[model samples]
Target: MMSQKLAASCHCGSVKFTVELSEGGFDTIRRCNCSFCRMRGAVVVSAPLTGITVLEGQERLTEYRFNTQQAVHFFCSVCGIYTFHQRRSNPEQYGVNVACIEGISPFDFASVDVTDGVHHPSDGSSGGVVGRLLYRPVEKDK
Candidate 1:
């Protein structure tokens, strides 16, 4: 598995950036069933802050913070597309929107595991972050 540089942008193209994908590709993508994430509905892949480079449109990006305000969500003000966010769990990394990455689709994933954001470790809620795994069936040869 070789790491690849991926291009990402907002729906209106007001925001553009590049991210270095992990060698395993979308295998690292995950979803969160937390109040905010459940509504945002974007599958995310992790990348080190150093791996993400905002190429343009930084001024057009809006930031939203809530709860502990540790997690910072970035969205395109013009297109209202969620591009990525600074992970609350790991401040040194980011969760990039899988759908925003060019040449990639969320459907490319066979399944995605949902993190138990409701039971976050920071709050000491327990039960672990691996909440539920959603499966997508592919056609099987007869």
Candidate 2:
């Protein structure tokens, strides 16, 4: 597998950054039909919460939540760019919009697993999303 670190940023470029992607290969990413997700036209760059780090713009981010409110959407307040969202289904997972990534582009949605956020509420808790992701290998890379 090819290990690579991807750089991503907001539309205005005020929020500059980088992400160390999983080398095993990352998913093609998915587009949601949910109310909020659909409108934003965002794609998810997932990794465990611990794996993701905001390289900059810590103060420029604005968070928004509604309804079950487990999902927290992070946006660049200055540019009004919805860069990523904390999945309600899995609080431990982050769904960063692939479109915002500076270096890479996700072109295949058919290959990615589609997560139905709209109907997740029926799943009881987590609305079907995983709670606090824990993704790592048993062995360390040396």
Candidate 3:
């Protein structure tokens, strides 16, 4: 799989960054069912920790953590939009929000696998996909 570099920013454009996606690239996109994730509801793609660089507005970013506090979520303080997160499942990788990436949207995928974050693998449970989110577009009559 080839890696791709993408530009990303918060809704308000207060935070800007560049991300070099992991080898799996868009294939790594997924949704988590954790408390925070369920509320934020952002589709994410994987990138190595070193693959992301803050291009601007680093001071406008804020960190959020909860539960085990292993995963560090980053968002723009101005727009309050989640930009990326250090994955608890894989500390070496960050989950970059697809919505924040240029030319990408969560609706682009027809079906996205939802990870069972409620029963996290780090908690000694077999964390597998519990369900999938499907996007169906209605066609307009001519």
Q: Write the per-residue lDDT of candidate 1 for residues 20-139, one digit (tens) a residue.
A: 865456777899878999899999998878778889999999999999999999999999999999988879888999999998888877778888898887787773557555557778
**After superposing candidate 2, which stretches have Cα over 4 Å from the reference?**
1-3, 22-25, 106-113, 125-142
- Best-fitting candidate, measured by TM-score? 3
Off by over 4 Å in 1: 22-24, 127-142
RMSD of each: 2.9, 10.3, 1.1
- Highest-lDDT candidate: 3
lDDT string for model 2 (35-134, tens) is 8875776667675566556788879989999777788988998999987777776687677778787755555333444456676753663343322222
Clashing pairs in 1: none
lDDT by residue for model 3 over 90-127, one digit each (tens)? 99999999999999999999999999999999999899
Worst 10-residue lDDT window for candidate 2 reads 128-137
Who is ahead in lDDT, 2 or 3? 3
Q: Total clashes, candidate 1?
A: 0
What is each predicted model's overall lDDT from 0 to 1? 0.86, 0.67, 0.93
TM-score-wise, the better of 2 and 3 is: 3
